[model samples]
Target: MVETVASLSGNESFDVVVIGAGGAGMSAALFAAIDGARVLLVESTEYVGGTTAYSAGTTWIPASMHMASVNRDDSQATAEAFLNRAVGARSSAAMRRAFLDAGPKAVAHIEANSDVKYRARPFHPDYLSELEGSTLCGRALEPLPFDDRKLGRAFALIRAPIPEFTVLGGMMIDRDDIGHLLNMTKSLASFKHAAKLLARHARDRIGSPRGTRLVMGNALIGRLLYSLMQRGVTVLTRTTVEALHTGKRGVEGLTLAQGGERRRVSVTGGVILASGGFNRHAARRADMLPGADAAWCPGAPGHTGNAQDLALAAGARFGEGALSHAFWAPVSVRKRADGTTAVFPHFLMDRGKPGMIVVDASGRRFLNENTSYHLFGIAMQEAHRTRASVPAYLVTDSEGIRKYGLGMVRPGGKGLQPFIDDGYLTQASTLDELAAKLGIDKTGLADSVARMNRYAETGVDPDFQRGTTDYQRANGDANWTGPNPCLGPIAQAPFYAVRLYPGDIGAATGLVTDTNARVLNRDDQPIGGLYACGNDMQSVMGGVYPGPGITLGPGLAFAYLAGRHAAARAASPEAGHADAREETRAQTS
Candidate 1:
């Protein structure tokens, strides 16, 4: 059962104390609890599931038991080769090997012992599909839809997904559900599916603010919370870890503060730091992500780097030589009724669709619009260096807006007046007028649109090669009858546009850890009783966004390793510590 800091009697002891309650930390707590260790899960926020709850929860765990269900030809070797080609010298081979080795074991272990279930996505491809060894499917696993009602009152502990992402006044839906809902009137199977969802959501609205039928990230968190409840893991929300007490053996205990009361708890096993990352840490944000606007970042709030700071004070050092400090996405911002800014990431919805083009202030196409969100954000920053491209324009015609929508505007172009009034979306009847409103060069905009129309007829984007890759083509309109699914003439009247900014989705540079996820000091020696995972640890990909769910993939694998290692330590404290010290030394050397 979850309780506040008031539940602690000030004399409690635990075998494992996980400092964060996102997917990584919760999984660590579960892995420890299942291995017969008393575990305590802590979250500074009132709710659990940090940035993870806001995500799509697509985990890229290769060679799992579920992989064969989608792509039987995929293998660990192929995934490794893809990682090598994609990640290259950005990260460590040893760390990547550790992640690859433990991925299937971690998934199998969690499923066998808990209610957390996952199914391989039939068509989710690697982000960089053009690279060698990249498969069309089977590496990515999506969490099965979970009934949040099973969590009982603890359901409130799960973080709510972004309000804009829901429908019908808080009905959460997944990719499959979206298809059914969109095609309900055309197909019987789709109609039945849509009807069932609507009926359940209607019933759920009586006592709940949102639907009880959770999908995507909510389903993943719901399953984890339910499993944690069954294991009787002590979960403390709205609690902060004040300080870490270390001895010759390493982290021995920590001070926790909650509700104006403080308590010191002892841990015989270890402390796992999975407190998101430094995305919101003011000093670190300025130092690492210099000049990046905080309003542009859409990550969850609990990642203040408090735990990371505590670790750094204990001699921990951040990893070096990353390609980027954080993962990136081009996001569109809008003001909510609550007066808070809503930063919506443009991922796999409109950018690659037909009849769309992203342009700089000069109204020139700067990148392949069909590129991955990470690459698109990188392009924005690179283009900004040369000209005014920080707030780039994503312009589409009337047909595109009705079919794919623009930014915050929904499909079929419903309720667009409100968006226009709020200045979230800009609408104009012609390309020249639209360019004038967006402050783009009218001649450049006209030339660009003309080129796009010519490309649509020829089915080739010779300049940027938009639809040349598997991932890009998949994101385009498959049902589109045009010569190229990704290319459609932007000649329709009433063109629409939204401004885009590069948003840091999550942290990539973090505290250094060994293969076993043990935090390392400046000299690269393991802090015996200290461990880290998720964004709290240096990414195995060295800040490269190799594929879908790269962050969560290594996060889960290392969480498994940390949990199992902590449990083994609890069982044989002296022997486990000695073995770990030697192993870490060997690995580092």
Candidate 2:
């Protein structure tokens, strides 16, 4: 029942207007509608899901109802303690508290009122498991698989997953699906599961462009979209906001343009900015993240800081004191058949696996290879200051490559010639040969390899302690019957390597907002009828990537807060004025 508009030629009115059709925007629109407010969801792109669709869809919400299903010992107090140790003073305590308190409520409300549902991941560990009060599981939730066949022709409206992430010409798979597909020939149950998936995908290809079996972030987006459609929300895609119409009270309306036609839209509740972030903004990137290359970034393209610019012009200031201006990950680049560059983020797939070692230009190990992708990226940047680590080499021998794969190279090592032909992957028969081809110190490379071999034999990486942490161990091959799951000798011939660059995944510094998710002015006063969430709002983690789905977790929670606050404002207009003044006094004081 969703109204998809092509041209905006008439003056319209809505209670809540949400910019960007990402997870945050969709959640905000849904929450507002649930509160009896007429909602409008807008997107600059043709599809609904943003960078989220390209992700693994791990939502980190502590102490939710699903937690006890996995780990009954998980408590809000324990989660808070973990945050205190991991995040500390990098972000505001109030914002963190607000997220913790509202997260479960948001999850519960959405599940109760809509098609969206989540279950706790059985063994998803916190990235920083070494930190105090960290639990092995129960915090991160996974979206259940959704049938896109229910969407019919509307299936195309959902954004497709990354090309490299899919298999069999766009058949999307999840963690569970991956295991089954890999073991299909060996196990009967896995074969049945994989057979069913392949059968469904084959049937879907007959009519649709891709598979109708949705999982991960696409499932989350599809569920949200379906829920919004059921509620009759108006969605306008490929539309750009030209201007904001504001009065003394605050943002009241927006000037939108679609297909060269302009229309004025009034909003009685508020405008919520969830337009990703400033990662794609050239000016912002130059100002905030110097020396970072956009070619390395794998985020969605619609996040160009357009909404943030409007808020800044209205006196909204960016948050300060973040450890880094943006979140980052180490990515390998390759040119696809479509002539577009594919920047693949190396997160938890091959880096932490045995027989892998990343080396700098001097052919020296500069970091713990098993560390989180965010820390790995930061280390690359930090190492670049002294040595040439911008394009670090991820070296793995033939055995390793065959077992774990490198970058875009799929496991089982069937289609490696294409990767090598495109110069995306470097292959050499010997360690010294690889060093020579990569223009690195041959002696340094040999020494590093020897040291790694010894460490592998002893099952202790004394240099960087690769397998010391629980997270690292979990990321390794559990089937390995060795002293250390994350350690293995790189003695095989025909080494493979892929170049890695630091990629800014999302912005951490963005428009400042209160605990209620209302955008604030330069003087710390709430801008009535205005709000921000997702990457458009400054990260509550203060630029730290604590665990999987950190971005989506806070994004959904704050979107709920903003939606409820805006709906209440719509119910009582006078309360908006009083709440604004009270918030101003409280923040300024």
Candidate 3:
């Protein structure tokens, strides 16, 4: 679907020019186009779908009307209360109300406009289950099932999640459903799944592929984009937004680059920059989050805050230390440089997959073993104050090796054992030898080990108190008998260690936006024709991951708002909302 090229002398115009063809951008484009706005979506990659394409592909909305239809107690008031509590008292009053008021409408509009169907996950809770205002269901909603063929030739334009998160996902499965798949392997219904998969493979052999569909985040975007394309939104991949130009009132146009060429477009409606945050930019990371010394982001390489810079140029106010980092489970993988390093989050989240440890510079326990990804990063920040590079250990037993398949690439050999054989990992027959190998006070190591053993025996940690919280205990091993879930102690023989620290998925800091997504400028004025969403701006949830699809949820909402507003402007330029302002300072630092 290539469009004919045309040269522009003064300015190029469209109803909306959306930067970053990821979830939010794509969502906005679809809505804008539907609103009868001439929409143009620009992307840096050869294909659309940003880091979200690498995600499990679910959209989570709590107290959703969809879930309530399935027999749950979800009302608009309850939804507002949940978001208000999630944001606490640190948010713009107008923005918070706007998010609550407009969230459901956004969901409904997208559901009706896109090829995707919305489904409420069976039972997903907002993080912190014990909280008073939390709801057990109806708050989280995800994209329903979809077929990849709907995209027609544009199927390849979409990317699927990495196998780990997407193997069972259909671009729309709820995050909790991931844990369920491991449980569903024997849920009797597996017999039908096996047959369907076999049938699809057989059809592939005959060249009559039909129902081998795209699901989860991919499915969600595929369906959304399918509808968007049908409505005539032009998604320009491998294209970049070079500059944002203002008119008499506010933003009026943008300069774009593609294939070593640049083009300027006039946007009568506006420009929405949802290009995502700069998680991989070390310089930006060091400056925005001074405590986040080490980051192992799982986001797209192109996520370098280009949109944030553009928003800043237009005078958008930023949130308070709206940290832009993700919590990784800490897994060891071979880096592109052929060096071995740990990928946080994935390692810690899936206990059955692999196991690792975390220690301080002196090879001592600094935080609870099983902590929230956000909290763990904070601990890492605190530890970095004493040294240029803090030393930590990931001690594991031989069983941890065989059961979880723990391994990391080394110069000569692979896995942590070589590190033990070499001097990289401290190895010891007794806890004393292991502590000696770690170069710490042996007594302290032995004492730590003994304390851990006691906790494992009773399933109740005394010190730092691991597995004590409702949410923190969710990741604990099932076989453990103590009051804590992930607690079983580290008393096994032939202990192993690997160096580690706080490595986040990405940063959370971004531009301060009203609930309706109208970016407020430094002077507390609306930029008239501009908007920003996704990681390029401050997270709606302020970097605290509450439940599944946190980023996707609000990102999708603001996106819908941006598109709705853009389309409305395209229809009538004077119909803009008047009061989206700069009081969003409490959102980030």
Candidate 4:
């Protein structure tokens, strides 16, 4: 069942070869193939979709067609303002210009030609209080609906990573919807919502049409892949491109591997390396982020940046600061039933706990643990440099566990069993045992407890002055009638301890490229026939998770551009090498 073409000596190679079949790679391959040029897509894993399948599946494409129809209008000027504000000065002028210009067009292209559907709902807000151009809902385009059966074998590759996660019509549910769902308990409409989800699951079970099984990220990519297959794009899964065949000047093609056999494939058109980053590589993580040696990634396990190494071997110079990383949030973890692992999102779990106080290695309270993953991860990183180890503690009392949601095995419940059993949670009749187990000074913890108790009695936190905003207190429990939402005295018998470590959604540092997804050399020159996307490439948000699907949006867009541009050259024999040697040599010299 495996086809191996040993050499491209006399054989006709594909007009385009996309290295990686994630959302970005798939989009690029499909775009190129449908445009009439022969295409080949190589994926490291036996399956296609990458980190995207595990995501919420929302795409942040501002000024998209969906937005325009819903009256969420924006001009080049508005888009520019937003990018400049979010990225500040990290992104180049040319890079910013290319992203803004092509962003909407990318959205339009998928909507018009692809099997995708979208609706406008703009109530989501940016993480930052000061962020602008971050519209709540409409600006973020979500997939309308998808039927799983249409995917066939490809459906097996798609991830059902999140279970028991009820959603409606591709709508991302936040705290508001949770409240609404709860309030509608006896209402007929509530039953309808419940019925739809149940029917969707039931239908998916019986292989009877998957109409109602429409989730977000999977749904979006599912529709995109369906459109791609219809375009005659042959997705060669379980294949890996090991090397980029570059000449003295630019990349020529790629050497592909399938089932332990190697073959040379011509990229006469070009090659796009959207193969992803090295998050799963322990060595890389430890090297990039100190103390990351102990950390684990929540990103897809398939990403190893194989294409990154291949590009460098081909003499591709890396962009300046190419090693910069993002998305390293400190997290608490426990073993799953499968003996694998499950990392709980810290922000979601930490904010709602009662009598819980997060401290640094110095047993000192630092930044709020309730911040977004990236922000908290950064704080943890910065904290590591000063303290003996990662500085973070979640001190919760019995009442807090009973009241606030700790994200245990059950939803909205205290997660005490795992922590206590794993020695991370230390319960002591006296605070000293808890402090000893946590490796903290008992007096320091006692002092912290005293201040917390005073704050609880006075109904106001004086130490950190917590809960200055609704966002901060939104995750706190209302059971404690206090000026402070989550604050309570940890003076109860049996204190608990959990070891804190920095965790990441994935390694954000990746190969640097241009707007067209072309890999850039040290001098900022494009290495023709080479490109990268997804986590393998530096993020467009300058390391910030601007919103949901922030990483995947540009990942799809640039991969589409990379594939098309390469295919254009492949389809036309007259695309003679426009010598950039002089320019490149001069710059390198």
Candidate 5:
């Protein structure tokens, strides 16, 4: 039964105690419970899914069983080669091997044991497909759509999607739904598909707060939560871990605060720290992040690095000094009708669309707009070193706006006046006027547009080589009849632009851990009875965005390893006070 902090009493103990109830924590608890361990999953907030629920719920696991079903070729050796080139020396060889080996096993185990299902994105290329060892497809897996009505009363616990992503007030659409809706005017089949989806959504909203049909990350979390329920796992909401009770035996227990009451809970298997990262922690962000404030961060507010802090206090070491501190993305901010700010991540939506160019304050293109969001954010950061590029501008014409849509503006949407009136989108009759409105160099913008139009006609971007790679081509407008799908003339009247800023999607640097998902101390020795995964542990990619699901893929894999390892250790006869003391002496010496 899902319990509230108020219902939980005095001293409680479990074989495994999970601090966060996100994808990683929930997956870990599910696996541990399935292994015959009493698992207690706790969440600081009323909801379960953290930043994961806000994502697309794709996991990049090479050579997974689902890939074979899609006829995609992948292997661990090829994946390791890709990591060697993409990650370089940022991550250790041992850690990379552990992930590459365990990722497919985790996927297979979950699929066989739970109601959670995933399908391979057969044609999705890696973020850096041109890099050595990167595959054109078969690495990314998306969660299958689920019926949230199965959760019944527990449906309220799943975090809702951002309002901007939904359609027709509250209807959640998957990637296939989006394609069908976008093509509804072209074909009768598509029109029927769109109508059926809308009708179902309408019927669902009659008695539900949101659509009962869940997709993407929401579907992944919902399936996992349902599996946990089936396994009889106890989930305590509105609970926070106050401190870790550690001794020579490593982490023995923890103090929990819930409903204004503090209680101590002992853990035998271990304490798994999956409480996300320090993305929302002000002090920690200032220390580790690139910018001064996390104003544009789209992560959950509960990701205050509590688990990382508790692990550090218990002698876990910080794995810092990576290539980048966090996984980066460029975001566009606007004020909603409710007086709250709406931060929308410009991820694989409009950047690669035809007739658009991302320019700096000087009105000059700096990087390939068709590249991955993480690389685009890195380019923005690099541009900021010499010029004012933090709040860069994405310029496009009226045709571009109508066909591809700018930030927060839907494709083929007719409500441009409202967006312009609210100052979320800027529009002008000419390029010069648009540059003037955006406070950029008008002459430079005019010249840049001329060059871009020439590139559009010739289908060749000599300046930055946009739309040159398979990865870039996959994200571009495929229906364009031009030489390059990503290229289109920006000659239409009434140009538009939106302000963009560097936003961190999640933290990459976290607690140092060994291959077993055990947190290592300052001496690089695993701390007995203590483990970490997800953003709480240092990313195996070493701050590199290899593909779409890089974060969640390894996060879930390591979490599975941690749960199984902890359960086995707890079941072992020798895992007592003497074993803990012996490991403590070895570390100390």
Candidate 6:
């Protein structure tokens, strides 16, 4: 239940207090409440979803119940083998084993107990499908579309979708909807589907603030929020945790500030920090991620590392020396008419499409265009070490733009004047002219284009092997009749280019915790009455972006464990006190 600030008193208490109402925090609260614990979920912003509301809502979990239905040969051992190769020695064996064992149970429990439902993507390959033990399908799970009208007035609490992805200003569309809308002119069946969606959206705008048909991350958050409401969980938005109230036994409660009033809330179970991450925290980024900037990040403004700071102040240790400090992606920026900047993340969008290539400032192709976004970002970082490759360019031909669009420019979009005028996109009739506009070496760009054309004609990228893996081919345009779906000649006139920058999507290094999601000190001793999940917890993949939704999969699984464990401890009088004493002795020794 959503609570008002006036109802809160300085003397309020609960069995468990969860800080941050993102996917992890919300899921933790729901599981705890279902386990018969009095739970309170707090959010810094008025919205509940945080960065998750803006995501694709795909959770990459191997050996999930969703996978079981598809009859894939995925098991804990196979998943462990894949992680060992992909994550290498960066992550602990216990953490990887725990996630593989608990992921399916967490998904099944939530689905059976609440409105949350997920379906397996039949052909979504792991990001590194060439690696052994990586399956071609039945691992990634997408949340089913949800009707937000069920929440009634509470629906407003959910964060809205990004404007660029929506159509007609506020209507949300999923992958299937986009396909239908794109083919509406081709067939009567598609036309009917498009018409029906438009009609519902139009009607929805009349009585509602936004479209009620929610998809992607919004659907996942909506389902979790609705489940929390049904379980009678107390949720307070626009409330920030000021400080953790720690005693000799560890964190006993927290001091929260809401609307200029500070309130003290006591908790016996534990405090779970799931406040997205430190992506937007300037100091944290500067200290941990030296080259990254918050301005380039697309994470929610509330992810300011508040939870990480509070945990650190309470003696929680930070996970150090991961494969990378943060998850990365390439982002393009364009100023909107309202003066605010529109940042577009090129995730499986224009990069994998044919007739396009990302080139460095020297106008040379440095990496495979069909590689995963995370790997692409890493390559950008590597290039920056030797040259000014931070602001690389994604160059494509007129045919590419008309078919796949570039940045915020939609496919077949009319009136390209605004984009050209605003300088979000640049166009040139000749390769030399395009090179001049981009301020790069004309000879290098011309030679690169010639090589790309030769590769396009032969349907092979000998330099980088653009479409060798199932993962690469899956992201490419399947309708093209080229020898390789990801390779096409950029010989069309009026070539275009968009500047790209390496952006940190989320933090990978965070509070180090054990398999039970209990926050641990520098001595590897669990701090009593303290736990973490989401980005607040050090990533289980050890900062490696193995596939889509790797962050959320372990986040949800460990959060489930945290909730169950906290509730069980709260039910026992001696457990919490005894554990604190044991940890204290271990730390001192």
Give lDDT per model, in order: 0.91, 0.89, 0.63, 0.63, 0.87, 0.87
- Candidate 3 Cα errors over 4 Å, as ranges: 2-12, 69-71, 74-76, 82-86, 163-215, 280-283, 291-295, 321-333, 336-344, 351-357, 386-392, 401-445, 478-483, 491-499, 576-589
lDDT of 2 by residue, 161-195 (tens): 98889889899999889788878999999999999
TM-score of 2: 0.97
Give the TM-scores of the predictions, in the order they appear: 0.98, 0.97, 0.82, 0.83, 0.98, 0.98
Candidate 4: where is the Cα deviation over 4 Å? 1-12, 68-76, 131-138, 162-188, 206-214, 247-249, 321-324, 347-356, 361-363, 388-391, 395-404, 412-500, 579-589
- Could you tell me which 10 consecutive residues in candidate 1 have the lowest summed lDDT? 579-588
What does each candidate score in C-alpha RMSD? 1.8, 1.7, 5.5, 4.6, 1.4, 1.3
Tens-digit lDDT string for candidate 4 (375-428): 767777776787754647766655555444343332333555665676545666
Q: Evaluated with lDDT, which candidate comes out highest?
A: 1
- 1-589, model 3: which lDDT tens digit per residue? 4342233344557888888888888888887887788888888777677877766565666545586665356666765666666666454546556666666777877677667578776655556555556665666776766667656677777765544342322322334443344345566565455555545545643543223455666667777778877888777777767788876536778887776677777888878888877665667777765554444555655676777787787788678733334433343333323453324344344332123345664556677766655566566666667742244566665555544433342211235545455554555678677767667667766666667667666766667767665555555555544555666556567766665545555446777766657677775556678887777657766666656676787777788888888778767755543322222232232
Worst 10 residues of 5 by lDDT: 573-582
Instruction: Give lDDT: candidate 4, residue 138.
Output: 53
Candidate 1 structure quality by residue, lDDT tens digits, 1-589: 7776777877988899999999899999999999999999999999999988999998989999999998999899999999998888888889999999999999999999999999999998888999999988899998999998888898998999988888999999899998898899999999999999999999999999999988888888999999999999999999999999986567888999998988899888899999999999999999998757989998889999999999999878899888889999999999999998899999988989999999998899999999989888888888888799989999999899998888778888788999999889999988899999888998988988999999999999999999999988999999999888899999889999999999999999999998999998877878778899999999998878878999889989999999989888877889446845654674567
lDDT of 5 by residue, 228-324 (tens): 9999999988888998997656787898888787888888888899998888877888877756358798777678887788888877887865788
Clashing residue pairs in all predictions, respectively, total 0, 0, 57, 16, 0, 0
RMSD of 2: 1.7
Residue 324 lDDT in candidate 5? 88
**Worst-scoring 10-residue span by lDDT in model 6:** 292-301
User: Deviation in angstroms for 12 in model 5?
Assistant: 0.9
Candidate 5 colliding pairs:
none
